[model samples]
Target chain A: MFKDAWLVASKDLRIERRSRVLTNQLLPFTLVILIIFAFTFDTHPNLLVTLSPGLFWVASLFAMTIALQRSFSLEAENQARDGLLLYGLESAGIFLGKVVAIVIQSAIVELFIGFGIVILYAAPLHEVVFLALSAFTATIGISCVGVVFGAMVTGRSRDSLLPLLIFPVVAPVLLSATKAWEDYVRGKVSLGDPWLGLLVVFAIAFGAVGVLTFGSILEE
Target chain B: MKSDRAVQGLGLVAVLAIVATYILGLWITPPAAVMGNLVRLLYIHPPVAWVAYLAYGVTSVASILYLWKRTRDPRWDLIAASSAEIGVVFTALTLLTGSIWGRPTWGVWWTWDARLTTTALLFLLYVGYLALRRATPDVTQRSKRSAVAALIAFIDVPIVHQSVVWWKTLHQSATVFNASLSPKVHGEMAWTLLLGFIAFSLAYVWMLIRRYQIAVLISKRQEILLQGALDERMSTV
Candidate 1:
């Protein structure tokens, strides 16, 4: 299972590297969202700084949608999904591999968005470690949920459906991640710990669910 | 035809129960000392909310049955889909009635209160489930994907509720719209609430049967149409 996972992950990452889709498209899209938020709330810098945590996660949420779309779109061509099923690849491995690839891609966009939030909103860069850890765990939860829905919506032309499906479901992730970041930024580390813990719990629980259910989804 | 008669009988009983509930709730029950006449909405609101949760619970269980290899059946898929449709309607009513109930009670139509937020999220999640069903063109694929989605979304409900409750507590805003069952149910009001639950549950049964029948009929029609098309092509060839 681990070997199959690595093979799948490497294939996806190699495709992503060669295509440069993340750098050329999704990264800039997230930055643009950051810029738009900066302008939308340009009334005062202080307000922007206070709201940066939410804005950062909202941008990450949007980027997660695109990353999920790209992940499944890679399988849309030439019966690739059929090949995976027929070739005897472990469904759990494929599920984890896809999740890992999406997490990596989302993390890159999240890091850029984090930097953009700092530069654009003038948020103080004090809780670097807390922010990074919170963001990493939250991204895992987001990716796990996103990949499951992404696979579910494959071969369907309803582009709007993915976000509509994912946004409400992942509300807890957004709520916790945003609150954790807010607490960290406001220097209330103790308050943020529970939310961070919630993020980790969500990530693991959803990842396990994905591993258990992906085989059914893939075969069906 | 037999099942149709049963559904009709159930529908009639549901209608009668609902009407009885309305009369009891509006006139027979004494006005609440606390909420006054506004307590009338309670009969409708709580029952609708009950139906919503009940319907979703049915969907989730049916989905599990459909997904399990040993017990997989097309009827479970139909049950899941039909129950989900009913669930969405009840959820919408729950939100609407909750909002209406809140206007006078909470002094606002809506707040980020835990139950209300969780219910809204539940509504959206199932809306997505229905949309997923519509988006997938294949029957088997649709059933499988939707069943899985149903289970995932169902599992998320408690987590969403818990998180929202925690978030509310952390913020320490006094929630005006308390969702706990009133500990002080007395006399006719209790009877009326009971009637409301019974009426709604019967209504859910009637609706699920009708919706499931329609779904079966539609699929049968599609099969016939596909057969006709294939026959025509074969004749031409």
Candidate 2:
């Protein structure tokens, strides 16, 4: 299972590297979103700093949507999904592999976005460890969910249905990550806060759910 | 025909009971010591919200049954879809009535309070469920996709609610209904409130039955149309 998962993940990442889609298109798209938020709130530096965490995640979600579309279309556009199924990989492994690929891509993009937030919005980053930890777990939950729904909406209304289906289901991530990061930036980190626990729960719950159901969706 | 009669019967009783509850709620029962007339909505809002939760519960259970190979049935899919449709309507009413109740009470038409935010997300999640079903035109694929979607939404809702509740309690307002009106036990208000629950439950049952029947009819129509199209193609060949 682990071998199969690695095989799939490496295949996806290799495709991403070969095509340069993530860097060439998605990164600039995210940068534009960050700049747009700065333009939206042009007044107080303090307010912009406070709102930075939320604006950053919001932009991430939009970017995540396009990236997800690209991720699934990598399969659907060329019958790659059919080939993968015929390769006898376990569906759970496929799910995990897709999640890993998206997570890695998102992580790199987010690091850049984080810097963009701090620099452009003049946001403070006092609690680096806390912020990084929350973001790691939160991105796992987001990617786990994104991969699941990304596969589900592979066919019909492929453009619009993906985001509408995903954004609502992963809303807890948005709320917790934003609050935890907001607190972290203000140096309000604490031991065993509920937000971190919530993020982990979301990650595991969706991880299990995606594994159990992805086979059915893939067969469909 | 008999089931149709039964649904009509259930709907009539629901309407009559709701009318009685409203009459008792609006005039028969004395107004509360604090909220006065605003308290009457307590009978309306909670019951509608309760039905919303109940409808989603039914949807989740039906989806689970459909997903499980041992219990999979097309009828379960229909039930899941119908209950979700009803759940969306009740969720909408719940938010509307809650907003109406909150405006005069909370000094704002809307607030980012825990329950309100959670319920709003619930509305969006189910609306997405319905949208997902609409996107998938295939029958079996639709069933599988929506069943998974429904269960995922169910699992996420409590986590969403808990996160919001903790966020509010830790820093923001602890609870939205801190000045909540408790139902007086063994009084006319309590009975009317209880009646509100019964009326809405009955209404939900009636709606579910009607929605399920409509779904059955539509499926039958689709099958006939598909057969007709296939026959024409074959005859041409």
Candidate 3:
């Protein structure tokens, strides 16, 4: 399973590396979302700073949707989704693989958005370790569940449908990650643990859901 | 759809029981010491909220049955879908009635209290579930898709339950009528609350069976249509 997961992950990354979609399109889109928030706040640095944790997750989640859509669209074309199953690749592996690819893509966008918030929103990142850990767990939850729903709407209007399907599913990530970061920044570092624990549970729960259900989803 | 006698009986009972609940709630039961007339909304609000949760619970259970290989009957999918459709309605009513209850009690139509926030999120999550159902055209595909989605959306159920416990809440905590087995609310109010629970649960069961019947009929029609299309293409060939 691990070997299959690595193969699938590498295949997606290789395609992404050559196509430059993640770097050229999705990354810029996330940065744009951050800037849009800055403008929406009327360039009030203080308000932006206060609201930055929520704005960051909201923006990253938007970008996560685009990245997921791109990830699945890569499979949708050329009947590649069927091809993945035809290769006798483990369905769980394919699920984990897609999850890894999405996680990396989303995290990069998250990283740039982290930079964008600092430079544009004037929000200080006081605890780097906590922010990154929260992002890591939160993005895992988003990607695993995102992958499930992403593959789901591919037969229809995926671009629009994916967000509606996933935003509500991944809402816990949005809520917990934002709160964890908010507390961390307020210097209540220990208070972040409970939110972090919630994120992990969300991640593990959906992660299991993805692996168990992906086979049947692919068969369909 | 032949109207099942049992279902008809259930519908009559549900209506009569709900009427009893309403009459008792609105007129028979005296107003609270503090809340006065405002307390009447409690009868409908809690029961409606209970049905909403119960509806989702039914959906999740039916989904599990559908997903389980040995027991993967088509009826399970139908039940899951039917329950969720009404579950969304019940959830909407939950929010509406809660909003009405809030205006007099909390002085706001809505607040970001933990319970309210989680409930709102659950409402949207199931709405998305229904949208997902509409998006997929294949029956088997739709079944699998929605099954997975249903289970995922159900993750919030526990959180919503615990939200008040975990966080500071504008929504009232379970004081008299809480999870504890002890009773603080008594007399007509208690009996009416009990009737409301039974009435709503019965109503949910009745609506579920009716909706499932409708869905079965639709799927049957769909199969016939597919057959007709296939027959036409073959005749042309």
What are the chain B TM-scores of all models? Answer: 0.91, 0.90, 0.96
The predicted structure with the larger TM-score, 2 or 3, is: 3
Model 3 chain A is weakest, by summed lDDT over 10 consecutive residues, at: A36-45
Candidate 3 structure quality by residue, lDDT tens digits, B34-55: 9999988878888888898899
The deviation in Å at residue B175 for candidate 2 is 14
Question: If the candidates were sorted by their TM-score against the true structure, best first, what order would they fall in?
Answer: 3, 1, 2
Compared with the true structure, all predictions reach lDDT values of: 0.85, 0.85, 0.88
- Model 3 chain B is weakest, by summed lDDT over 10 consecutive residues, at B174-183
lDDT of model 1, residue B103? 88
Which residue pairs in candidate 3 collide? none
True-vs-predicted CA distance for residue A57, candidate 2, Å: 1.5
Error of 2 at B31 (Å): 1.2
DockQ of each: 0.78, 0.71, 0.74
Among all candidates shown, the one with the greatest TM-score? 3
The TM-score of predicted model 1 comes to 0.93
Candidates in order, TM-scores: namely: 0.93, 0.92, 0.94
Docking class of 3: medium
Which stretches of candidate 2 lie above 4 Å from their native place?
A189-193, B156-186
Relative to the unseen true structure, what is the Cα RMSD of model 2? Answer: 3.2
Candidate 2: count of backbone clashes, pairs at least 3 residues apart or interchain: 0
- Across B1-91, the per-residue lDDT of candidate 2 in tens digits comes to 8877877899999999999989999999887888888889978987887788889999999999998999999999999999999999999
